[model samples]
Target: MARLIATAEDFAFGPAGKLVTVAEELAARGHALTFAGSGTALQLAERADCWDEVVACPTDAPEFEELVGSRMAAADLLVSCVDRPSVELARKHGLPVAWLDPLTWWWGDEAPVWLPDLELCVVQRSIGAGDAAGPYQELPANHVVVGPIVRTGPERRGDAGSGPLLVNFGGGEAADWYQPGRDTNYPYVIIDLLLTQIDLTGFSQVVVASGERIAAEARRRWPDAPVSFECLGHRDFVERLSSAQAFLTVPGLEAPLEGWAAGVPTLFLPPSNSSQYVQLDEFRRRGVGDLSVHLRDFLPPLDLLSAPLRDRSERFIEQLRDFERTPTIRTEVAARLSDLLTHPEGWMPAVRRGHAYLDELGRDGLERCVAAICALVEREGESA
Candidate 1:
């Protein structure tokens, strides 16, 4: 058995979830694994039990580099979720690294000197075509375009019935900027807006599967609403998503991909990051999902706040304020949601297109990824 270290920036569940899936598969195949990340990544690594040790390697921590270096020194190989520091550190230790990039957004921009030995990109062919005519085209030593690394849930029972509208906006602590501090908090602004403009008589149930704090805040805001707030574990979250009839979320890769895998239509909110914006744009271009509504359309502009919001980019803040101030924004958003829920058939074209792409990509990406990692390990043994 070979010892491997897997690392990612402690951003959200997407990176950590992918690493957990790979680590679990490798562990089941008789490999020793350690997971090093921050925030939700560390939390998930511990809960999943896919790693021998779960290390808190936050980027801002003073001894982050020392901790990562110490772990890499003991491992025969490294598999990372496309972090430059981890990749460089693994190379410094002369360990082969497999970089798993689920978004495929890491073009050859400002890359580190020591690239990964294998670059496994989890995206559709059109996204990972590598057709950029320049040095960027041939960036990695071994570039492989794999399917989306989605977490599978139990076979959904036929009697699950029409599930609630599953809502999630990635993981990690919610930013305070989005919080209005009224009765509603950040991230649930849309829910509050919908509540004001629409009767919600047509919909039976709404579920928000974010963290406990968000769920608690949601309940505090709308105590009488039919919405149920839950902070589920990874497996349960996927199960809920699979049985859900529709989705309302930030346009991140994992949640949208899960929604597509389940063949449900999603109504997206404006993205919180540049990578998400790009990916969501691609989804719109490909007719995989509907275009997201601007944040201003759902709530009052951020500039109206007396003080600057923390933990948000100035550019995003500016964009949020850039929308034309209009009194009918809530009515417009309500109309859009009404159309989406009442006439679900209008969304079938996009839903079918997304499912078809997922079908062609196949669901055995984790198996293929495991095989590739094992091959790399065997090759190192042969060389030794």
Candidate 2:
């Protein structure tokens, strides 16, 4: 069995939850796995039975480096979600590491630079980082393009609201990060504008998932709005996505990926003239969902393709949104992911052969890309 140490050390939402899910799956396969980190990660590690050892670092322990070094030496494989002290420690010990790809508009210079250094970089195929970075194409060839490994088994049952618009914009250890940016002309900004333009009386509920300050502000502004707010675990969040009608947000890689998985139709707001727009284009090509330039642009396209959902309640709307993100490719990604785990030498051939649609898209075009995603998802279900 491949002994693994899951590094749940990121502050962001991308990888921490995914790492826990991967650890559980790996443990079910009988691999020895441990979790090491501080802050909220300590709490998560405590609840997980998959972990062989939970190394808790003090809030500000000076000997943290030495402690992490010792832990890294103990494990043969260090599968990480976050990249910080954990990435550096993995490097010092020469352990294979898996880092999540985060490429949104807000990312700084460091995002692309650090990802390449890891022994294996597991990225969302949607991020397009595989094509952008020379390291993915040139260097040690450790990049593994796995769809974000999410919890898909079951969800807590909740009666979803039909007319109510559930806006979930925050979930993580700290809720303060998803602050509404007034200046950025992103989807969040566009969402705010559309909410105001529409008749408030038409919608039954306006649920907002966010920090206390933003939630409070939303409630105050729309006092008559039937708004409910609560913190949700990962499973609950996925269940909510499964039940929602339509999603409005910046065309982020993660949200769209989740929306696609649930088959929920979405309206993506991309920065003008960005390559990021390509992600949404692929979603549209698959008949997965729609996109808009702004609120006004949305009305016409939505009126044309989404008559069934046009005047529906939030519950009905959410149902309409569930349009099958990319079919279901969990198995193919997992198979490829497992191949990398079991046979290290096989990485280059699979990547070079453009395993699945990645290669087809490279040779063919957008149509091939869509076919690849569909094939990947169906094949995963078959294998499972």
- Tell me the tens digit of each residue's lDDT in model 2 across 1-384: 555766754343344555665566667766787777664455445556787787777323567667767767766666666545677667767765655443321233335466666555554444333445622344335554444444432322223334444455432222122123321222233234445433334334545553334445556665664456544444555566666544443343344455444444344443221223334454445433333332222222222112222222233222222211222222232232223223324323322232233333232222322233334334433553
Q: In candidate 1, what are the lDDT values of residues 1-384, reduced to their tens digit?
A: 998988765555667767777787899999999877766666667667667887776644668768877777777788887555677666667777877776444343344444444433333233433335523254455666566676444433322245567777666342322332431233555666666754455445777766555667778878887678776666667777766666777777577777776666667766554345455656665666563564544654443212222323444544533322344654576566666666666555766787776765567666677888888888886786
Q: Model 1 TM-score?
A: 0.79
lDDT of each: 0.62, 0.44
Model 2 clashes, total count: 17
Candidate 1, superposed: residue stretches over 4 Å from native = 65-68, 106-108, 116-139, 151-161, 172-186, 198-204, 211-213, 216-225, 291-314, 321-327, 360-364
For candidate 1, the per-residue lDDT at 373 reads: 82
Per-model tally of clashing residue pairs: 1, 17
Candidate number with greatest TM-score: 1
| TM-score for each model | 0.79, 0.53
Task: Supply the TM-score for candidate 2.
Answer: 0.53
lDDT for predicted candidate 1 compared with the true structure: 0.62
lDDT of 2 at 36: 73
